[model samples]
Target: MDDEPEVVEAELVEDDRLPAIAEDRSPAVLLAEEDPDAWLPPEAEEDVQAGIPKDTSRAYKGDMDRFAEWCETVGRRVMPAAPQTVTAYMSYLKRTPREKTGRPYGPNSMDRIIASIRSSHRAAGFEPPDTMGARKVVAGYREQLALAKDPAAQPRKATPADRRVLHQALARLDRTTLVGKRDAALMLLGHALASRGSELAPLDWPGSFTELPEGGFRVRVYRKKRKKWQNVEVLPDPELEMCTVTAVRDLVEALAREGHTSGPLFMRIDQWGYMGVEMTRNGEPIGDPTGRISVNGASDVVSRSIARTGLPGDWRSHSLRRGFVKSARDAGVDIVDIGRHGGWDDQSKALIGYVDEEDSSGERNPLAQIGKAAMKKRGDGGE
Candidate 1:
């Protein structure tokens, strides 16, 4: 995602030089009581009223808000933005300390913030201000920054866990509970499919997860990266206790017993074990899954499953996907096959060396290999 827009891992403190707004002034009161400014024409107003994609809209609004705050700090006009104003904002983003870290925004993040600003300006019917050649400023800074860094002292990436760490996490799940069973299946399928949290979060049962021959199953997912629904197969584990199929089977039957056969595959469960229902407050069939989990919720569930396992503090929903890649590479699976799971582009150097052009076998799907490897390791008595 290029990390899904400048995620602001660093902190930029508010400039103390700026005047402080009164704490008692409510934002709604200020906006409502303020004098009338320029207003949008009907069609433009209608376009704004029409629904927008939630993700991009949030991102754009966030970028604009940050830009406004920065403008206020520097005494610049935000709406009729000048090129010099854009340049100053970009400079601040690059030089300002991020969050608690003294480090400034990274090149990838800086580019996204600039893109967000550009999009907002264009949407407002103005050409992007050409200060520092507008977009070219970011390009110039990236090149200059690249040259400034000592090539050998590259930032260290988070330590990625291997298959054993994953197996240990999976073992910690208490399979006696229905929620536990669902968690087990979720871990396996997420790894097996090499899926993203966005893909895993909104899954609809009886549709997204389909049955296959011989107790195996094929997962159909709509991945944002792929721009369409795609299917990846998960082979049943002969070791009944750990098989993804068995876990899902149990979870499905349990949910169906509560009169749920459709809607989100991963529904939120209350502490008392209450799940989503098709009925409303009046207690009638509503014909849908009553509750849905969020992307962050999906990550939280995975974290809770492994909380006691002591693998690492940073284990996340994406941990399963990374574990799949590491496990596959350790098993000598080709790079080409790895990219095939979610149609990930292989041209990036990140997928190199471990990839084999001619290493085709019965195990074309490396995700399945994760189960096989984890099972083998567990069978070897905590190897």
Candidate 2:
């Protein structure tokens, strides 16, 4: 948001500081710790207003909200936070219920919240908070996470799929109908592009996926992290059953019949598992349009695919994107190329197992290092 959240100009945190321990005065801040455009000069105070990217603002709020909630529970102030309080907050987070997974947060998820808290504090005009103690807290959490990372300890998010596994998941669906065709197309293109479920339903026929003279599709991608649009090419597959080209072509035609030609490529299918441009009751369009499939709905497609095929109980929405990295890395593709294809500026952020400890340098792709063979194998399978 352009405007900063209002805060009391006077710091209300002196009373909130955790009591200092006399025995070990060695100081260490636990977690590393925004503004409006108008009164502040535009360029100099850019960080004050547009400091955080718009796409991530929701995440920023979520992190701070979580932190704020914890602080409230312990009767501490959120702003001008104390080193001890931050440490305590991390501990609280660790203690919270964490689904089938034993730990509340992964190292990466914890780091994201930590960064968000720091950013929020800075945006509020606080000093750059010392993070001396955060290293220990995060390290501790990481160690705990490592111990519990086994398949039994953590269900492990829909395990990344290899070509055979991916196609096998695809094989569970019935491709003759609209829902089948759309799901098939979604998974095929989604894996080929290494896209998140959130990115799939927003794709436009004419805008995002454009027809190319030579055959296949040119998919324009709006990256969530980068907040920029770029095109990725999908060539015609030699195999017809699972070809990205044919799958999408059939979907586009099917959607066109349903009056969804110009907008979102993936639309909500109704009770009979039919795609309709609007919510229809007794064949009549009703209320607001519910045609655009939600991220959750798209995710269910993957989950259902896994369930029907009996692939694995832990498999969920992230399988395809994660699979992209695992498949590419297994193929020994270059890291930089992978980053470019995956739209990740930070190659180190790719799915963890895709690279072992020796290769975990922050310089590889999170997904695409270039290999359509896996996706092609998927596209050729008849669901």
TM-score of each prediction: 0.67, 0.69
User: Per-residue error at 129 for model 2, in Å?
Assistant: 2.7
Candidate 2, residues 279-351, lDDT tens digits: the string is: 6689897643756777667777777777787765455456667667766776777767766786777545544
The superposed Cα distance between candidate 1 and the true structure at residue 288, in angstroms, equals 10
Write candidate 1's Cα lDDT for 52-157 as tens digits: 3345556556667788788878878664478888877877776688786777766565665666666655444335566555456666667777788833123223
Q: What would the TM-score be for candidate 2 when compared with the true structure?
A: 0.69
Model 2 poorest 10 in a row by lDDT? 3-12
Ten contiguous residues with the weakest lDDT in model 1:
9-18
Clashing pairs in 2: 33-118, 34-123, 34-124, 158-315, 158-316, 173-383, 242-379, 242-380, 338-368, 339-365
Judged by lDDT against the true structure, how good is candidate 1?
A: 0.63
Best-fitting candidate, scored by TM-score: 2
